[model samples]
Target: MFKVGDHVVYPYHGAGTIQDIEEKDILGEKLNYFVVFFPLNHVTLMLPENRVKTSGLRKIIQPKQIDELATALKPTESSTSKKDAARPYSKENETLLKSGDIMDAAMVISNLTSKEGERTNGLHMEDRKNLDRAKQFIVSELMLVNDLSEEEAYQFITDNSKGA
Candidate 1:
């Protein structure tokens, strides 16, 4: 269980700090919960202690670990064509979102950014929306570990994400 003052990331809610932890009765079930406060959105979330793992809740990544994600942001040489690109793209993004894996989240940013390079017409509305969410998660995490403004985080991702 995460203690108060610890930074954590919730799959559905991005990253935040555990403002407090307390027990509350919900439907007569007295259980523990972590109260998280998101800086970016100014929103507070209360997540159950028991469901932490299933909810994809975990501590923030260190700055050094960002190097790993940076590699994922790099562009690949081969361009494999997709039969029905949007379908797979959407499904993959959804999986990552629900999984709340930081690396996979970074991969989404890299994949979507790189895919934009391949598409002359640019990403569809659906892909663009997903891209926005993916990028926000990355940026949110970066903001916590790296002491960066929102714009700075976005630029950092963009700069490192450009293929070598």
Candidate 2:
């Protein structure tokens, strides 16, 4: 279980610190919750303590894993095909975004970016939205794990993804 001051990732919300754990009374029930504060989004969330696992909340990637994350961002042959066409509602990408896994986020970034390269008209509005969201997830974790500012984290991802 995460404690106050721990850096953790909440799926689709990026990384945040567990600011506090408190018991709250709602609907005549007293339940424990984690008060998570996401600096990137400037938002705080109250997550039920018991749902951490199912909610995909987990610790940030360690520093040693940074190299692995970089690898995942590198441009690669995308699995996206004409049938999938990198649609905004792609189930595979949606699942990756919700997994709260750094590598998974990287994969979405890679796939979407590559697909964008293959298109002349650019990404659809929703596809562009998904790409931005995936980038934010990576940026959030990088900011926490690498002690980076938001600008630095974004640049890091961009530079790494531009490589092979």
Candidate 3:
């Protein structure tokens, strides 16, 4: 279980801090929930304590792991072709985002970035959205963990890695 003020990744929502744990009566039953604040979107999320395990809540990557992520982003080949590289390609990037696995997240960044074409010009609509979401996940985590600004984290990724 995460304590208040702990940094955590909330799957598709990206990184957030546990602000508080509140116990309240809901539906006539008392349950505890974690109040998490997502800095990126300026939003708060309340998650049931009992559902934390299955909810994809995870601790942020360690500082050393940043280098590991960079290594993972150093890609060779994952997608089949540039034309069909969105949606079902690279597992939709949905599975990886849901896993909350840092390495998988890195692969999302790598795979999407490695796609041929500039930006969303040649990709399917869903694929473009997936790439944006994947970048958000990486950038959000980098902001808190590395004490870097949003632009810096993004630039870090662009400089150290390829593609997106």
Give the Cα lDDT of each candidate.
0.81, 0.88, 0.79
**Candidate 2 lDDT tens digits, 1-164:** 78999999999999999999999998998999999999999999999987888988999999999999988898788667776664555667878898888898899888878888877788887678778999999999999999999999999889988836
Residue pairs clashing, model 2: none
Pairs with steric clashes in candidate 3: 113-163, 113-164
Winner by TM-score: 2
CA lDDT for candidate 2: 0.88
Residues 9-92 of candidate 3 have per-residue lDDT tens digits of: 988899989999999999999999999998988999999999999988999988988887888876546546544554345455
Off by over 4 Å in 3: 78-91, 117-121
The reply for model 1, stretches above 4 Å from the true place, is 82-88
Clashes of 1: 0
Candidate 3, residue 80: how far the Cα is off, in Å: 3.2
- Clashes per candidate, residues 3 or more apart or on different chains: 0, 0, 2
Per-residue alpha-carbon lDDT of model 1 for 80-142, expressed as tens digits?
576444343877787887677778877777777777777777888778887888788888888
TM-score of 3: 0.86
Model 2 worst lDDT window (10 residues): 83-92
Better of 1 and 3 by TM-score: 1
